[model samples]
Target: MDFNENFVLGCSAIGAGLAVIAGIGPGVGQGIAAGHGAAAVGRNPGARSEIMSTMLLGQAVAETTGLYGLLVAMLLLFVKPLVG
Candidate 1:
């Protein structure tokens, strides 16, 4: 490949790496949320509905960062700048 093409490919790889880094927040947050949910369930089995709802909500919020990373990765792979 030409120098420019190689550079663009390198940048795309770098972009993917950077985007994946964003996943850390969501991963940690999701883990925390899961732990809380499990604790809550263990503490009060009767509140399972509430605990589950809250857990799902928190998990959904936490997932946004990872989704953003996925979006960036998809953009890098499919919408590359060098296609022209």
Candidate 2:
């Protein structure tokens, strides 16, 4: 391959790495949310169902960030938009 092709591939790899870093935020967020939810349930066992539902919903929402990051990384690594 030529220098330009190599450069594009290298940049794409770097971009995919950066994109994957986005997953960290969602993981931390979900952990914190789960911890708080557990604490909330412990404080009020009568509300366990409510707390669990809310926690699960929030976790599902938070998970989207990681999913988006994965999608971007896959696209960057496999699609190679800059190559063609």
Candidate 1 structure quality by residue, lDDT tens digits, 8-65: 8878978888888888999899999999899999999999999999899989987998
Candidate 2 lDDT by residue in tens digits, 1-84: 556788899999999999999989999999999999999999999999999999999999999989999999999899988786
Off by over 4 Å in 2: 1-3
Clashes of each: 0, 0
- lDDT per model, in order? 0.87, 0.94
Looking at model 1, residue 53 earns an lDDT score of 95
After superposing candidate 1 on the true structure, give the runs of residues whose Cα lies further than 4 Å from its correct spot.
Answer: 1-3, 82-84
TM-scores for all candidates: the values are 0.85, 0.84
Best by TM-score: 1
- Model 1 residue 53 CA deviation in Å: 1.6
Candidate 1: the clashing residue pairs are none
How far is 13's C-alpha from truth in model 2 (Å)? 0.9
**Could you say which candidate leads in lDDT?**
2
